[model samples]
Structure formats: structure tokens, C-alpha cells
Target chain A: MQLDNTDRRLLEIIQRQIPLSSRPFADIGVELGIGEGEVLERLRRLQEAKIIRRIGGFFDSRKLGYTGTLCALQVPRDRIEEVAAVINAYSEVSHNYLRTHEYNMWFTILAPSQSEVERVMEEIKARTGIDSVLSLPAERLFKIRVKFNVSEVPDAE
Target chain B: MLSEFEKRVVREIQGDLPLESRPFAAMARRLGVTEGQLLDTVENFLERGLLRRFGAALRHQRVGYGGNALVAWVVPPDEIEPVGNAIAAYPDVTHCYQRATVPGWPYNLYSMVHRHSEAECRELVRRIGEALGIEQYILLFSTAELKRSSMQYFRD
Candidate 1:
């Protein structure tokens, strides 16, 4: 999609850490020499085009006192979708992906406590009937920051 | 004379940041605007620190840096900065931060290491241990990536 100057500006603002204010759009508009209505409109279009997937808080689960673990499951080729469905149904399972590995299905879940973490794993195992699930919890978090460099976008101007 | 139409064009690109080369031009054409205009706004955002960076989300595992682990250290309050900086200086360490530790869990300093093999990752951790002089730590390997999407704050 051809993103004009205004589109690019709006994207850069929305993707980064949003201003912790009541009217973030208005605040962004004031800085960009645009209006709040315009900010809202451009964001709407971005969503329609599937350029921006979702607008929500990237919470620090650990800070929230939640235990997160990344688990991989070796699901049968045919039952991939079924297993994903079962796994996604759990509110605790926040992020799941289809990776290229012997354990093709990789997912992450956040539990309130350690016992809940085990319970979620057992539930997934029982429901999917997959015995080769590997639960790799962070024994150490060496680095954890989500920084996407959007400034590299070519400037056609 | 930027009206709602022009604003809509801008918002579309903001919410939907495409993962492709010439994504801006593609967006401009869809919104029926000149590429110059799109580039101008993007530049403006860049200058204002609104946009951090734009690049490819490479598959770290496929690139042979598959053995990634999160390591946390229990450092005293006064030592957090020194420990974090020491760990961050390592090329193998991709991420480093300090977070509050629970009563039972005293691990506050955290770092992530990416290597081609698990053994390599462990070796890097060992080097970090020697460099930091802190013994208590844990290695939390990611078994799965449950959710890995950029935050969308503009949604209704």
C-alpha cells in the first residue's frame, strides 16, 4: 500500500508507546499539525488495510504477577487446526504460532500462579492428546523488549 | 485543505503498517494520494520520535539462532545498574532489563541470549556469569510463542 506522508506519520505514532493520556489522538494531532478527527480516521483506514493488526496494551505479564511459559507441541500434521483451536480456547494461552520444527505448534500461556501453569499444560495435553508437549519456562529472561524499527521505511518524497 | 478523506488515508497507514518493501507507496495508491505526501508524513513522525523503526521481523530460529533463552538474575538494588550494563554489553545478549522481584523470587535482572545451539547459549550464559560475578540465575527457554504481535492502541 502506498502510504503518504500523513499515513506514515500516524503509523509511527500509533505503533510506539502511546501517550498515557486521556486523548492520545488529540495529543498526537496537535504535534503533527493535524486534528484529532483526522488521527482517528487514518487509524481506521490502517486497520481496514490490515497494516496495523491490533491496538492494545503490551502488558508486562510478569509485573502483573502472572507466570508465562512458552510451550511447543508436536501435533499430528492432520490435527494441526484442531489442536490450535483447543489451545486458543484457553484464556491463559495468549500467543500461539505455527513454527517450522518437529514440534511445529508453538504457543505461550500466562497463568496466575505456578500451579495454574501446570494445570493449563495438563488441560492442553488432555484435550489435544499430544504427549510430546515441551514446556520451556524462562529459567532466565536475558532480554525482553519489543522494539520494531519503523523509521527505516523508505521515503518516496 | 485536509478533510476527513485525507485523514482517513493517514489513519489507514498508521493502523495497518505493512511488512513489505515500498509499503508506503502501496498505501498511497490505495488511498489515492501522492507518494510524496505519504513520505512527508512518515518523515514528520520519524522526526517527532513517534515511530521507533521499520524493518523485517526475521525468524530468529530459522536463521540458526534457535537456541534462545531468557535469563534472570537476583541482584541487590544497588547492583542492578552495574549488572544490567555488564550483561547488555555482550553481543550475544539481545535484551536486558530490571524488574521488581517478588518476595520468594529475587530474580530482578533479566537478559535474553540467542545462539545457534543450546550448548552455545549455555556457554554464553557461563561467560556472563563469569563477567558479572553473580551465581544465582535461571534459564527460561521459550517452548512456544503464544502471542507475538505488535500492540495496536488506536483500535475502537
Candidate 2:
């Protein structure tokens, strides 16, 4: 699944933004000098390849009356998987990773309210019995933009 | 506050938009709104900062960025503003934040760095440390990605 120059350019454009138009793909096609059908076909293939995990709106959950926090748990080496399963059971937990630290398990939870976030944390603690959980909410956000320079990198995988 | 229609639009498009010639058409139909109406709402969301972005979310690994790390720094409380802004300026640094620190955990500023390799990631971290003139930090490379998914809202 090698991405050619056009595919690369397409990825770059869409990762940054897509037109807010009734015929957005047609607009992208014009920009790419292709047709709407080609744009749709390429993007469909990209989605099938799992290169594009999602294509949609990313809302500021905070503005929508949601609260979230970064949480870490110190799970014993043998119990890491079990504890992670417990924490990941909640839909609020969007990301869970095993990192190289004493507090090895780190995850993020975004819920409808602050109390909902707290409730999820409490339940995780109760189920896993990992009382050494640390919830570190963001005091300030400096930046959050996840876009890669697909134009430069060749298909490595 | 979000209008009722806006909430419905958000609920419909928070997941992947169908890959079609007119991706918003089906969504508009389901929500009982015209394509123009739905797109207008999304455009408004972007203008109002309710939506951070509306586009493709790429898998970094698939796109050749195999190495990623979460670097935590222990910056002095007063310098958080300058230090955070500096880190945020880097294109490779995707997320930067000043977070609450717990006892025994003094690292307050966190940044997520992506590169082609672990060695490259380490070099970037070292350069950042030198440029920022900060000493205490830890590079927590992910040993495993237990779960990664987008948040679903208004599903009820």
C-alpha cells in the first residue's frame, strides 16, 4: 500500500482541514486536480489500510461540558494487563499505555463532568485494588495538534 | 451553550464520517437536515472553537513515525509559561501541557514527541533539554498501547 505523491498531498490536506462545504470531496478534488470520485476512492483505500484511523470532527470536550484528567497507576509487573483491562473497561478511558516508570500505567479519561471522571477513577481503584492511582489534570494546555508530514516520509511499513 | 441541532450534529459526526462523494449527506439525512445546513453547523463549530479540527486522524506508526515518547519535565513553577510555550513550538511535539504533580512525582510539564526511531527521539529530548536549560526529565517510551480510540459523545 504505497502512497504516491497525490496520496501524500491528500493526507496532508485532510489532516490539517477539509472544506466545510456541501460537496467537500469535490472541493478537495478541485484542489488536487482530480475528480470527486477519485478523491473518495483514494480516501476509502486509505481508511481500509488503517492508515487513516478516522475522518471526522474532533470537538473540544471541555467546551461541551466534559472534564478529563491524565491518570497513572503503579501496577506490579505481573498484574499490569489485569489492571489495564479494568481501567480500559470504562468508555471514558480513551488512551491507556504501559510506560517505563514506577507508575507504569497511564491513561486519560474524558467524561461528561468532573464527578463522572472521579467516579470512573474510584471504580477502577475498587476493581483493581491499585490504590496508588494518581490523577493529574491539566492546569493549562499549551498545544495539541497531531499531524504528520506525510509528504516527506516514504511508506516504511 | 450548544443548540439542540448542534448537539445532534456533533453526536452524528464524532465518529468517522462515511467515505463518500458527499460524506455529510447521509449524516444530514439522519439528522433531518439538509447537507448545506449540516455543513454550515460544522463550519460554525470550527469558527467558534467548539471543534478543534475536522479531518483525518492518521496512525503515526503506519505513516512511518514509529518512535513516540511521553517526556515529563520538572520545570520551576514560575517558568511554566515560557517553557511550555517553547516546547509547544516544535512541530514534532504534538501535545504540551502543564499538569498537576503528585507527591514523589515532581514533573509538571509534559510533552509528547514523535520521531522515526527511539535514538532520534532521545536526541530530540536532549536537544530540547539543552535549549530549555532544564535538567530533570524522564522519557517514558510506551511499552504497550493497551487502548487507543476516539471519544464518543451524546450516544445516549
Candidate 3:
């Protein structure tokens, strides 16, 4: 997906905000100097190309009384895929990833309560037959902001 | 406890918004509210700190920034604050947290780093380690992201 300056400008606009109004596209279009229909069409193309993952509201689960934890598991090499499937089955598991380490498989689970998180962990152990599951809940969160720079070239590799 | 209408708002708009001229208006119709009312409700939620942000979480890989790694450093008890602040100051460090360590895994401080390539990710780890003077640390690069979803509250 080769993004033009206008596309980058649109992404920059929406990354921080999207007006909560009857015509948010028109609001953005005005800033980009493009028509509402053009804005809509470009966004649709971005979606089709898998460029824009999501555009919506984000809520704080901790403020809403939810427990989240990052879990790591040492599944046997041959069973990584199989165990990952079992772990991904839980709705609480928001993120599942295969990483490079001894405790290779990692995932984060967000549940309504601590007990629910524990129950899901036990269930995963039981289902996957892997005892090396380690739960590393956040003791403190230092920073949690993520915003990608759109206009400038990305930092060098 | 959240009010019934507030819960409905969270449930309805937490997912993808429609890609149209009047996305919020369409959502307002579905939730039995006018566009102004829906917008005001969202404003209230933001003011109250319930809603984090109403924006797009771009695919980092798709935008040319490619590599990602979760580095856990075993910072000393006396240096946790300084180390965390320093790491979090980096733009590419999206997440920095102090997590409980298990028996064998001694690393306690975690920072998620994103770079343009795998080599750059390694470079970031080295730079952070050198700058922080942390001798013991481990880097875990995600080979695959099986699932990634934003957490939603008050789902109904």
C-alpha cells in the first residue's frame, strides 16, 4: 500500500482524533482539502489493503474493573502451534504471540477479575498439558502511549 | 457501575466505526440517540477518563516500521524508577512496565521496542542496555502475532 501525502495526512488526522459528529468525514475532509466522498473512498482502500487496522474508541479496562496479565508458556517445540490454538480460544486472551526464547509463547489475557484470569490460566494448563505457564501481571505501568509518525520517513533499520 | 446508556455506547462504538460521511450519526440511530447526543455522551466519557482515545491504531508493520521485541531487563532495586523513565522516554518504546518475575526468570522491568528491522531491534536492545548499564537482560522477538484485539469494556 503506497500511501500518498494526502493519505498520510488523513492517517495523521485520524490517529489522534475523529470528530464525534454527524459528519466526521466532512470534518476530516475539510482539513485535507478533499471531498467527503474522496475521504471515504481512500479510507475504504486503506482498509482493503489492510493498512488501517481499526478506527474506534479505546477504553481503560483497569478503570472499568478488569484484571490483565501477560502470560508466558514453554510449550514443547513441536506443539507450539497446537498449544497456541488452545490458548487463543479464550476470549480473555487478547494477544497471543510466538516469541524467541526458552519461555517462547507469550500472550496477554484480560478478564473481568483476578479469579477469572487464574481460572483461564489453569484451563490453559489443563488443555495444553504444559506446566511452565508463568503469569507476570503488571506491577506498575510506566508508559502506555503509541503513536506512529506518518509524514516523516521511519527511523533507519 | 456504569449507567445503562453508557454501557450501550461503549458496546456500540468500541469496535470499528463505519467508513462513511456520518458514522456517528449511524451509530446514534442504532443506539436510539441523535448525533449530538451521541457525541456528547462520548465527550462525557472522555472527560471522565473512561474512554482512552477515539482514534486509529495503525498497523505498525504496514507503515514501514517492521520489527518488534519485548525486552526484559533485571534492573536493580534502587534503579527501577530511573531505568523505567529512561526507557519509556524513547519514542519507539511503546510499552514500559514493571512485572513480577517468576523463580528462574530474573528480569523485572519490561520495555516493548519497535524498529524498522530485526537488526535495528537488536541495536535498540544494545543501546538501551549500554545506556542503562544493565548487564543482564533478555530479548524476546515475536515471531507471529496470533491474535491482537483492543480490550472492550461493558460488552453486551
Give candidate 1 misplaced runs (Cα > 4 Å).
A154-157, B1-156
DockQ of every predicted complex: 0.09, 0.86, 0.69
What lDDT tens digits, residue by residue, belong to model 1 across residues B15-52?
Answer: 54442334456677887877778666555544543444
Best by DockQ: 2
Could you tell me which residue pairs clash in candidate 2? Answer: none
**Residues A61-90 of candidate 2: C-alpha lDDT, one tens digit per residue:** 888888899999999999977888888889
RMSD of each: 12.0, 1.1, 2.0
Report the Cα lDDT for residue B128, model 2: 97
Query: Candidate 2 has what TM-score?
Result: 0.97
* Residue-level lDDT tens digits of model 3 in B13-128: 88999997788888999999998999999999889887888988888778877788999999997899999999999988999999998898788999999877789999988988
What are the TM-scores, per candidate, against the unseen true structure? 0.52, 0.97, 0.95
Q: Write the per-residue lDDT of candidate 3 for residues A103-128, one digit (tens) a residue.
A: 88999989888998999999999998
Worst 10 residues of 3 chain A by lDDT: A148-157
Per-residue lDDT of model 2, residues B54-147, tens digit only: 9989989889987899999999999999999999999999999999999888999999999998899999999999999999999999878899
Tens digit of lDDT per residue, candidate 1, span A34-116? Answer: 98778777767656665655553333455435676767689888997778889888767756776545667877777767998
- lDDT of model 2 at position A48: 85
TM-score of 1: 0.52
The numbered model that scores best in lDDT is 2
